[model samples]
Target: MNTVIDAHNISKVYNPTTIPVYAVNNVHLHLQKGEFTALVGPSGSGKTTLLNMIGGLDRPDEGNIFINGIDITKLSANELISFRLQNIGFVFQSFNLIPVLTAKENVEFIMQLQKASKQQREERVKTLFAQIGLQDKLNERPSRLSGGQQQRVAVARALASRPQFVLADEPTANLDTKSAFNLLDIMAKLNMEENITFLFSTHDQRVIDRARRVITLVDGRIVQDTAEVSTQHEEAAAVKT
Candidate 1:
């Protein structure tokens, strides 16, 4: 199936017993393979909330989220954890790398949890670092690398297990302009060459500009969803809103 994500009538409410506030209110979404999509809106628009639910980090109160035909919202806690490990990749704003681990080690950690063979881990890490143009920094720790380099390592880590799709929440929020553009370049290359799907929750205009599909949210609902289906030059110009 082409649909990697299918969310139906999903809703999340905070303080439902008292001052009920709907963080995500009955939203439906579907993402096909190879899509580079941006979920954007103002603060409190439920971008992160919806992303978390789709990534299996949080559950919607009212509906189901299906990832590759599996209903993640119905999975038990332990089942959900295992499912996420195998099927979902996450890139967060903080560049969440292990402090003591080297770049190679940090990327390989998830593979270790899945009990990948040493050869498999080593080869996968090598390929990912090469793809992200960070072969020299493989042995360096997160503290030794610059913010952009660290974020590249984080991207490598996210791709280690070959997740169905990647969910990145404000990945460029802490990056400088040059760094953000560099990261976007790498991600766009991956999306085009490797057909890796990415869904991002971001307020950064740099990210929004590069996305092939843009989903806008307002007050916990999807207000607009625009896609570009044209020649390369035309697609580049189309997302410039």
Candidate 2:
């Protein structure tokens, strides 16, 4: 598999106080194309900090991040912004939808920033809303939608730009069990069907169970890395024999 993201000796430190605190300490990770990976850890374990560094939303105090073989640390601010907009999608624990905008409008917002043609934006937003089963609610604002619905809209927005990789921070944190599972199912389907890589920082067991690979972090260090055996892959291999 082609490597989609790579990190080397990444570290982040907070220097507000007399003594510096290392949020992420010399952590390294690599994610391949089409991989569904869960970055699992407790609060303050540096999962989010690591994720932010990978997404280019936050820079590491030390170390380097390479996305699609480009060293992100070497990019200027404007170049980083352009790279993130073109190649990365983000989903947050909070839906992060603008309350005033309708679902379709919210999804269209990112495409608009990318300077998509009006017709193209309309077609893409409509298709995404339909895929998320929110076609009927596309005209409704976030305030009018349920938590699950809002998150679905957020997912649609994240995919609007057709990014190769998505970085999600506690995406299922606020959902109920049913909602969380449903969201995971959608994400899993997308990961397989679209061949889009997903990297998540989550404590949710549902999210972990759905992941093809799990990386556990404790106290700013990776403690465990495991790959789940896929039954479908096994079955296909058996059939060919």
Candidate 3:
């Protein structure tokens, strides 16, 4: 598989005073195209920091990061911004929707940034809203929607740009069990149907069970990496027996 994102000997340090805090230490990771990966760790484990570095929101102090074969560490600020807009989408724990914007408007905003035509943006947003089962909530503002509904809107906005990769930071942290599972189901379908790669930083077992691969981090370093066979594949093997 082609590598969508690659990191080598990456490290991040936060200078609070005279002492520097090592947030990430010598971490290396490679995400293949179409892969669904979970980064699981306890508090202060640096999973979010790693995701931010991969998403170009932050820079690594000690190493290089390449996304789609381009070394983003070498890019200028303007270049990095453009690269992020064109290649990556992000879903946050807080469902970072503009509260005043309607669901449809929130979804259309990113496409507008990409300079998509008004008609194209409208059509795309309509399709996405319908796909995420949010068509009825199109005119609702973030404040008007339930937590799950707002998150569905966030998911729609992330896919608005048709990005190659989506980085989700604790996407299920605020949801109830039913809502969390629903969001995971939508993401899983999107991953399979659109071939969009997803990387998540989560401690939730629900999210971990859905991932095709899981990377466990401890004390700022990856301690274990494992791949699980998909349920569909497992069922097929059983049927052939």
Candidate 4:
């Protein structure tokens, strides 16, 4: 598999001169295409900071980040903005949507920014909404939908641009158990079917259990990076042995 994201010696400090708080320090990471990964850590472990650095939302004080071999840290403001728009999809905990826009409109917004054809945008929104079980709610605005539905729409919106990898920060933070499972099932299905890479930052065990790979961070350093096997796998192995 191709390396979709490469972070080399990344370091970020809140205040360098006086009482420096190192948010992230010497972090080296790489993500392969189609991999579903979660960065789990305690509060202030630099998960969000590292995620921001990878997403081009924040710049690191030192080191470089590469997406598909392009050094994003070296790009100009406009260039980086364009790159991020085209390559990365972001899903924040807030489910940021235009208040007045319908779910369909919200999902279409990304492709509109990409200058995709109207036919393409419409087709994608239709398919994505259907895939996420939101086809019936297409005309409804965000305020009209439930928390779970809103998050589903947000997931649909993230995939609208057909980005290389999706960065989701606390995607299921507000969902109930059923909703969270539903969202995770949808995302996992999409990952398998479309081979879309997903890198999410979360602390929830439900999210952690669903992830294929778990990367744990402690005090801004990755303490654990290992492939994850589901409970079903463990049970099956026990029976076999």
- Report the lDDT tens digits of candidate 1 across residue range 1-241: 3999999999999999999999999998989999999999999999999999999999999999999999998899999999998998999999999989999999999999889999999999989999989999999999999999999999999999999999999999989999999999999998999999999999899999999898998989988887523445576787874
Please identify model 3 stretches exceeding 4 Å from their true place.
227-241
Please give each candidate's TM-score.
0.93, 0.91, 0.92, 0.93
C-alpha lDDT score of every prediction, in listed order:
0.93, 0.89, 0.92, 0.92
Identify the runs in model 4 with alpha carbons over 4 angstroms from their true place. 227-241
Q: To one decimal, what is the Cα RMSD in angstroms of model 4 from the true structure?
A: 4.0
Candidate 2 stretches greater than 4 Å from native: 227-241
Residue 132 in model 2: shift from native, Å? 1.1
Q: What pairs collide in candidate 3?
A: none
Off by over 4 Å in 1: 228-241
Task: Score candidate 3 by TM-score against the native.
Answer: 0.92
Model 4 residue pairs with clashes: none
> How far off is residue 86 in model 3, in Å?
0.4
List, in order, the clash count of every candidate structure: 0, 0, 0, 0
Which ten contiguous residues of candidate 3 have the minimum total lDDT? 225-234
For candidate 4, give the lDDT of residue 110.
Answer: 86
